[model samples]
Target: MLTRLKDSTPKTLLLGGAALFSVFPLLSMLSAALQPQGSSPAGFSIPTNPQWHNFVDAWDVANITTLMKSSIILVVGVVPVAVLIASMAAYAIAQLRIPFGKVFFLLLLLGLTLPYEIVVVPLYYEMQSLGLLNTRLGLILPLIGLNMPFAVFWMRTHFMSVPAELSESSAIDGAGPWQAFRRIQLPLAIPAIASLAVLMFLSTWNQFLLAIVLIDDPNKRTMAGALQGFVGAHSTDVVLLNAGALLIMAPTILVFLAFQRYFIQAMLAGAVKG
Candidate 1:
């Protein structure tokens, strides 16, 4: 017991240090954000007179309301469609045994290996040719495609873990492929689907590179992308900048915090099943 405790002590200390390292930047940002709007905060000193209204001023300056709406619209467009397609494709590949399923799965795996930057140039040209440049659909479509590889892989892992006997039983009970998928597999896949949706929502909400490149108008870009304009305009003001960054980060943080337990459960389930 003493030896076990000693081993755990080192691991616990290491994790504690890592946690502090991760949290240090957020603490510093909070410190800076609470300072007087134009003041430069040194290190991580907390403000004696916290300017809580700095966040309000930053919100107005950043035009966060409009950006939030744009991000919501993008998320609405991308998440459902992406999740639906990925779930169906995964089910087919893992359960239905579609022709050339292995080949298709291999293609998706290849997609995961490629960097997003590699496709940006060609995507730009394609969007221009399609007259989709600077449009919300332009960003939405590419994001869905970009999300597909990992999304499919994640759902596939969950589907593959489901016992084949369940599928066979459903088929014997007069259930068609779609019926079995909807009734048996989908119900069982709720945890995975919910986690995937949360992840996709976060990805869509925080999308930066594609949001900026595909949509030239800052108004139509994701919140993170809109930060480019906010930063450019208020680069000199550290307080407002940090406040704005925190505000932009708040939704994803809140969302993950809310769903973290379920997400962890689903991830553990996948790990054990896989």
Candidate 2:
């Protein structure tokens, strides 16, 4: 028992220190947020009179309600469709033994290495040609495509980890490919799918550059993208800015908190192993 405790002591301390380090920025932001709306707060200093109303003021100033609606629309459009398509493609590649499966997977691996920035210029022209620019679908379509390679890769890893014998047994029992995938494989892949959904939600919700470039209207942009306009108008007010930033971040934080267990389980299970 003593030896075990000694062995774990360094790791425990290291994790604790890392947690504190990670949390410091949030603590500082909260401190600044609680300051009087126009005040420039010194680093990590607590206000004598906390302006708790800063959040409310910031919300109204930023018109966060409309931004939240826009972000929700983007999330709804992107996450489900993206996850479903990626999972199905992954199942086909990993289990169905489709023609040129390895070659297709290699293409997806290449996609994973491609920088998002490299495609932006071409995507802009493509959207322009398709009359998709300055529209919500404009952002929605690109985000789904941008997320595919990683999502397919992740789900493929999970499907590959599943025993081939189980698939064979299901086929022996007269289940077709779709039935086996829907009933057996899909249920088992919930943890990985949930983790991927959370990641997609985060990426879509916080999308900034594409949102700004593709959508001219700020009201149609994600919360993080809308922040650019809010900052432009209220650049001098640090307190309200921090409050607005935190408010924008609240949903993604809440989502991760809710699904963290499943996310951690998928990670521990080597969700990326192939």
Candidate 3:
């Protein structure tokens, strides 16, 4: 009992510390959001009377409905395209045994190293030349491009982990390559795909920099960009700001929670292999 208690004590402390660290900012934000407008100094304690309606008020004033629509548009457009393209590319790289497959894999992996910030200027010019500026397609195209590299790399690893015998068995049964991939390989990869989809959804949903640079109109801008417009040089509305922050975080949190099991399984699958 003494030995077990000693071993668990440090872990308990660490978990407690982590929980506190993670929850503190959120608690502070909630308190701020519930506070009445003009009731307290910035960064101060909770208001005597908390105003839950501030969330509704902020939603209206910020025109969050339109912002939510824009965010949804970007996410819905990018996630499916990114996943399908990445899955296909990964399948080809992992299963095709094509000539120069290693080279192609390396090139795809190299995309993981390239940061979006480094290419934003050139990307802007390219979009401008393509007559895509200030358009929804313009914003979504760049996000998809930026997300593809990592998506391809991650999905490739997952595809490569699939048993070789499964594909070979399907081939021996006279199934075509596409049939083998579609029927045999894809079903086994659902967990990894779910994990990738969740990650891609979160990244695209939370994207700020690309939205800010690519979209000029407020209506076209994403939640992150819209949130920035809430604060100004002269005055900052803490309650509404926190309310917006909370609203912005809700969809991503719900998505993660819904798919968290797949994410855990994928991570375990990757770890168990190596």
Candidate 4:
């Protein structure tokens, strides 16, 4: 009993500390947001009256409804195309016995090492040349391209874990390659695909820098870009800013919570198999 108690104490402390660390920032933000305007040296104070109405004011000021629509359009456009392209490419890399497949896969892996900062200039110019600059397509194409490397590599790893015998068995039973992949491989890959989709959605939704650079029109701006504008416009309004921040975070938090089970399962599958 003494040995077990001693072992558990340190773990309990560690977990307590981690929980506090994780929640502190959120608590601070909420406290600041609830604080009344012009009440303290820091320009905020603990509200005698907690202004929940500040959220509505922030939504109106930030034009969150329009920004949200733009964000949705970009996310919806990018996620499906990126996943489909990545899955097909990954499947090819994993299953196709093509010459130079390993070399091509290695090149794809190299893409993970290339940061967006390094390629943004070239990408901007490419968009300009293609007459897509400042358009939704401009914002979307770059995100899809940038996300592809990691997506393909992750999906390829998952695909490789699937038993080759299953494919062969399907072939012997008169299934064509496409049918085999669709009927056999796809079902087994749902977890990995779900994981990839959720991750990609989060990344695409929160993207700020690319949206700022590629989109010049305010109306075309995504939620992240719109949030930056909110900060600029309300530098002194702590309540409004925090409210906007919370609203911006809502979709992502909800998405994670909704699909958390699948995310956990997929990550475990990849980790265990890899």
TM-score of each: 0.94, 0.96, 0.92, 0.91
Q: lDDT of all predictions, in order shown? A: 0.92, 0.93, 0.84, 0.84
Model 2: pairs clashing at backbone N, Cα or C within 3 Å: none
Best by the TM-score measure = 2
**Model 1, 97-179: lDDT tens per residue?**
99999999999999999887999999999999999999999999999999999999999999998999999999999999999
lDDT for model 1 comes to 0.92
Superposed Cα deviation of residue 243, candidate 2 (Å): 0.6
Weakest lDDT window of 10 consecutive positions for candidate 2: 265-274
Model 1, stretches more than 4 Å misplaced? 1-11
What tens digits encode model 2's per-residue C-alpha lDDT throughout 192-216? 9999999999999999889988999
After TM-score superposition, what is the CA distance of residue 93 in candidate 4 from its true location, in Å? 1.0
Ordered from best to worst TM-score, the candidate numbers read 2, 1, 3, 4
Decide which is better by TM-score, 1 or 2: 2
RMSD of 1: 1.8
Clashing pairs in 1: none
